[model samples]
Target chain A: MSPGGEALSRILYVEDDHDVRKVATFALKAVGGFVVEPCESGQQALEKAAGFAPQLLLLDVMMPGMDGPTTLERLRALPAIAGVPAIFMTAKVQPQEVSRYRALGTLDVISKPFDPMTLSATVRAIWAGRDD
Target chain B: MTELMGAEAEMRDALRRLRADGVQRLGERVRELSAGWAALQPRRPWDDADRARLGELAASAHRLAGAGGTFGFPALSKAAAPLELLLLGLRDTPAPGGDRLRQAGAQVAAVAAAWEAGPAGAEEDGADPGQASPAEHGEPIFLFAEAEEQAMLSAVIANLGYSVRRASEREVLEGALPEGPLSAAVIDDAVPDPLAVCARLAGRCPLILLAEDSSFENRLAAARAGVEALVAKPLEVNELADWLDHFAGGRAETRYTIVIVDDDRLLAAAYAMALRQAGMQVTSVSDPAQAIEVIAATAPDLILMDLQMPGIDGIELARVIRQTRRHLSLPILFLSAEQDTERQILARRLGGDDFIPKPVDLDRLVTLVRLRAERARALRAVMESDSLTGLLNHARFKERLGLELERARRHGTTLSLVIFDLDHFKSVNDTHGHLVGDRVIRGLARSLQKRLRRTDVIGRYGGEEFAALMIGTGPEEARGIIDHLRERFAAASFETEGGSFGVTFSAGIAGNAPGGAGPEGGAEAEAMISAADAALYAAKRAGRNRVMVAPA
Candidate 1:
């Protein structure tokens, strides 16, 4: 259970790479014990986010069409998921880039080349760190 | 727990399958990236059409970088990253330098090499990279111990990521000198004539003595011989590693002054603010044309540049900078939206330090910049310092004098310049040998350093003569400080091999000569120095071993 007073069970995961998505979905579901709905690109995530009613928005930074940051901006405009918390997962992010991401009201950024075994624990820690 | 174990077992099997499936795609991706190697010729005309082709290549590399690390090959991602960055940077350049293009080729070659050697890492693709500590120190540590302890000691040090150069204690006693410029040396207490060996290695490198019993007498003897630390025989490897790090970190740490040249004002301002917060002095120049003036005036420790600018690009500006003899070796790091390859090659040839790919992780940038500046500052200190005594050299002292004077005048504050000459110096050298005379000089230099404020610039002006620039102080205050220094030296005991001896100095101080706020040409700097010289002559005539101040 998160500080939001609900169990963080459903995560709307967006990533363009099929291999990464396949492993991450397994990491979130089988290893992490969470119900995961995966989207292949930013466009698909935007289409599915409204109906999923996810506990969190797990977005990838680089995508083919809309990209991570842009998708977050567009998804935020919708009434259903306007105030939902978001986190960015990327390969590398500089300190300044982290500041920029934070200014867009992100919870935290998990770096890529991340160990799949510890993926869920990282997300749980992020959840625990936030008070509200 | 059993339920979790079942899930974990399934996860590993899934990981193995992911690697088997992704390995084919990894090979194809590297092949695609390598396909455009011929098009990256440095001599070829770089225009809009070439840029389009390079963009396509960069997109491919970018995809590979994001995907490979997640699959079986993290090395594949690491290798493709630099090439992708270089291509992305080069595509934006209107006329990229030849050297930068060559750098891109090298990165591409590296990608090919990484792919060849990548399968070894892929076997355990799901393993965590965070467990490894990056502990590779460049300088080798010197070891002088018993032959029995050599293997165990070297293994422990090597595991901590240091290369150890070992020597037997018997070899040293036989006068077989260890090759050094070594950072630190570890010696054993069991060694014969350990004090003699310690004396030789003391000032050259940090000495850590490994004591068999670790007694009080051993500590005292180690301290007397100038060993930095004495480690007990049953080694606390962690504690030993800490001491090594502490000594190595004690290099001249100066506050680096940096200039950021970019067209983006907001970006430059952000970086400047960040650097300032990190205890650095930073200046940001938005206009490329005005950047040259700023760079010249500041003579900054480092320059952070952008490859693409409006008036003149970073390459042309770097060329202009390299043309100047003084700034030829100044460290310049390129920070741009798309960083690397053609621009990198060109920048390296022009003596640029590194290409920090953007959007840069600020922590890495700060650390790298600090490391580069620390090395530059340390080298500059060696150049500016007097060899015999670590005070500023004669020429550097005078240069500091002018700068301090101008700064004091600008701030509407007082500054004092004092010269100290050892009295009866020729007679002392005649009575004692030249070595004792040199010891006396070093003794005076040490006393001055101990007594004077850190802000005061002290220098060995000549043989047996020293000068100090004391800012924000009046003549009366300056005279009081020097008077204390004079009495301290006259009474203080200086023990040498030739036996105990004492020395005194005559000091002349000049201050507030450039007084009053007259905007246009109030006082000349030459008059102030002349006044100090006259006062010194007066001190010599009246009596030596006293402090005197010139009339304002």
Candidate 2:
């Protein structure tokens, strides 16, 4: 959902694990009340990105075909959604890796084993405070 | 709060449903994959087809390992990890005997069986479903206190989000020490011969002493016992919490990179494994000739080099590294079996920061390496940082810019630079005096530091002007970020003696994206700086408080 007037509505989530995708999608839809289009792989994400017109890209770092950073690079090359903000979901998010992901222009990183109940709230907080 | 509870309930219900669905799907997949694996089982000598089959098994195992954990089947995940590793190894070598293949196949079948049998079977196999062990979480703090004090201290530490173990007796403490690596140890004064106990546990974990004695003798004894901190009782929970916070924040999980160089492979491996167990990223080099290459690639925080090697000695290697301008201040530690005092002195003279003898006590070695590396890092920060703003100084900034440009060229990535000058900074100084002007400058520095990503290196280029190196950012994105920073800075008010006033800045951005003109050397860095400077001037000419991107 759009936090204030920024219209951070459409979120394209790319995760490999079907179970995680299912639970997280339920959280975003029922708890977060946002329109979420979940993709199983980075390639599928790239194929659907322009058509979905998501305001934000929630990507998984380690995917099978075209990992999150490479996918972000390709997405940035496309004229549509070139400047959209992106966030990464990763399991092994060390301090150095977090900085590296940020260098790739991600707005933030959400570590894995995330709380399903609070996941939507966390996303909303990041979106609301992005201007800072 | 009620809405949040409702949402939580909803999420929990959804997760329960998903877990059920996932378990069923996992059982089906495991059965199919295990059947495929059993059919491919080698009866006699392994061949290419068997190797290919092993690859398939490994890939499926990898997927299972990842999915099992996510789907609330941690037992399956745990069983699959070693199997995956085993299969991958077999795929690589394929020469493992029939026994090895049999063991791998049995392990795969066990995992499949575990999945099929569901929760009851996993519990029967002694696998905890959702709970992770303490070691899997993080290193725990060990507290040695009197029986009366133990409960209070442990409760306080546990409340502070630390996994703590309490022991009142020496035997119990000694047994607990081997359970896992400790983050830190705290001892109460009531413990008999506390100094001796502290000395015994000193290098193993950072030790803190809580003593009632404030005498100089006791303080001196505690210092000699290698205690990092001594708190005079009665210890406040808040004070102990503060100390624990510092210890946890500075734990080795920060992943300080270390490079160990020794011609002796076994010795090097031992040192590497010990350091790695302590949470340092360690790379070992057996050949001194490859020392420079490894150092360049890893950018290690410390170098542990053996003094005596066959061809190039540690002294020569250290000298070679010192010859490189970038690594001049990097700490080089000498580890040697030689007992010659003269050689140790020579090694220190030739750029060795510290000397440790061979057959190093593992605990002492880890402590010394951590201390020296942290000290070197602090010294470097002081030397390279600006005094007023704490950003990189001009000279250090330029040096890093050159290095980052070289890296970007080699990696075929983009590097962008943003230069921002405070608009009418002279007028601010003229109106509010230099003291307030300094405050305004510091204010902008703080904002930049807070707003920019950690990977973006911000530096005070000169008086009232700041620059940032945005690695992997393009011209347009850099402009957007800088423009946002500019707008925020314009809106921020600064307090002065007279009243409050707002400050704004103009910025210029230049990026070298991939497939564009590649930056070669220091000259390219200089060109980028000049281009950004030219664009900054344009922004100033077009009325300040705006951002401009340098034309490609």
Candidate 3:
């Protein structure tokens, strides 16, 4: 049932919200054409970093346990997550703020209240932007 | 999920009861007012005797208008709005007809009747029942203070827009500053120790230190604690409001960048050092051309530019900076040796905060820069730049002055305002090339600054004019200081393009004395300037180059 664009190109999705995870999990499986793994917290993501071996990480900025930025900082410390293409999802995506996040090594930010239809395509686009 | 549902149900039930309580309270007040009106014994509903009764009814109507919304009876509240308007109309109408009286009376009565019915029709009325209620269930402000002094202190903090929750009486920290997004938080120097609180909210919120005692040790302690600012006791509420506004606007409150553009390496280094001493994050550029690019990347809080540059002049740099968004509100204070009113006015008009005529008055320049940064952070909503010296922008000064005012109001402290002006700044500019003339002005800033207390505030008010606020000082003492500054400035030997020149300044001093009003609808600090301005003018009229004390 897969388009078979890429296999085992690990995807790590960190979100505190369960409903968002449920919706995203389905979209990634059906449309993303890649392996998808979901984690609830930055700490949890850090713990599963070795085994999951994600090529790309999608992180939610605002969360209860360890925020996205802090999580990214910790991830940068780990050699496995180093140089991994990262994207942030946040409510604040103003030009100046986005630039700051970009300066911190984030390739792009997918704004919150994201489109359920376009989530997979956007991630694919970010992945492409990195190669170029 | 079940637990969450239970919590929602509890909230819904609490809101329902609150509505019922609001309605009952409104009904009781209305009935009590009605009885009072009946006892007044009016001859006719339209007569002058009914004036107090109408007033009482209007008061009840006003109360219901606010109260009704609490219970989700928004329509009842909206219906009561007309009564306020009608009552206003009646107050102006000398002889009102029975129709007006009957309408007002009926409206008030109907509001009371509606509330008495409880929150029955609230849902059907197209109002979000929950929207009409307070965010939290009635939680009376509690402060954990063993002593009355501490309690009073807590009251002051509570009044300043903090939800001070009392933890335990033994707890040194009063209440935990709610762990939510806060614009800014106030940490006292001693009790409710700010170190832990600042650490908790660090990088999340800007922290302001309220200094109970203005001692070197205290200030050092505050600085080590990583506080954004140290606002001494007798703080200004306006200043606090400014800090809050800066944070609320989501501007960087942690560190501010000041761009110094100069052709002279030595001079640039000196100015940068002075700015750093004032605690500003400084970026110094030896060339004027780099001002645009440097400012573009990281928008600085303020800019200090050398008037004379090798390629593009300081004025041109100022114009270019004005064109850039990063420098839009960026105060560009010219570090020039240009002293003409027309030239200074030109720089000011080009969006320059103020021009520090060189050989930069190190102390005054530093103080002015700090004040300007504070003002920029505080009054992001208002105009910037001081009128004289064209330094310490207005919005920035207002924020600092506001903090000073709030502190004064809280701590029962005295703040003095001193206004001083160059006795013949115009003639000097005319006689000497505005270049040499500017050196004299900068030199004067240095002299005057030397005469001030370390805590005193001095800013260039406008052309040949300056204002100083001496905290915890009286008018007499302020007058003495101002008079001394004037004498020293007059005696200074200023070397210019032509030759050495001597200059004199005139000053006026006023205190925020009891029953005192700010002159010209500004503020206490401003009023003091007005009094001082008037005194300065008087001194000029009495013959230039003398100091005049504001009339007691």
Please compute the TM-score of chain B alone for each predicted structure, in the order given. Answer: 0.50, 0.54, 0.32
Per-residue accuracy of model 1 over A1-132 as CA lDDT, tens digit each: 345666678899998877778778888887678888899988898899999988788988877788899999998998998988888887544557778888988998876655666678667656655674
Candidate 3 lDDT score at position B11: 49
Native-referenced TM-scores of chain A, all candidate models: 0.94, 0.94, 0.89
Count of clashes, each model? 10, 0, 24
Model 1: lDDT equals: 0.74
What TM-score would each prediction reach against the true structure?
Answer: 0.47, 0.46, 0.27
Question: Best by lDDT, which number?
Answer: 2
- Per-candidate DockQ values are 0.16, 0.09, 0.01
| lDDT string, candidate 2, A1-132, tens digits | 233468567999988878778877877888678999999988888899999999899988877768889989988887897989999986544557779999998888876545455567667767865775
| Model 3 share of native interface contacts | 0.00
True contacts kept of 2: 0.14
The per-residue C-alpha lDDT of model 2 at residue B402 equals 86
Top model number, DockQ = 1
Off by over 4 Å in 3: A1-132, B1-390, B515-526
lDDT score, residue B34, model 1? 85
Report the lDDT tens digits of candidate 1 across residue range B102-178: 55676677667767886645446645322211121244678776677788888867755566777855575663445
TM-score of 2: 0.46
Ten-residue region with minimum lDDT total, candidate 2 chain B: B125-134
Query: Which structure is stronger by lDDT: 1 or 3?
Result: 1
Writing each residue's lDDT as its tens digit, candidate 3 over B334-443 gives: 77666688988887887777877555545578778878877776665345544333345544655556656656665678787777777667888888878666666665
Worst 10 residues of 1 chain B by lDDT: B128-137
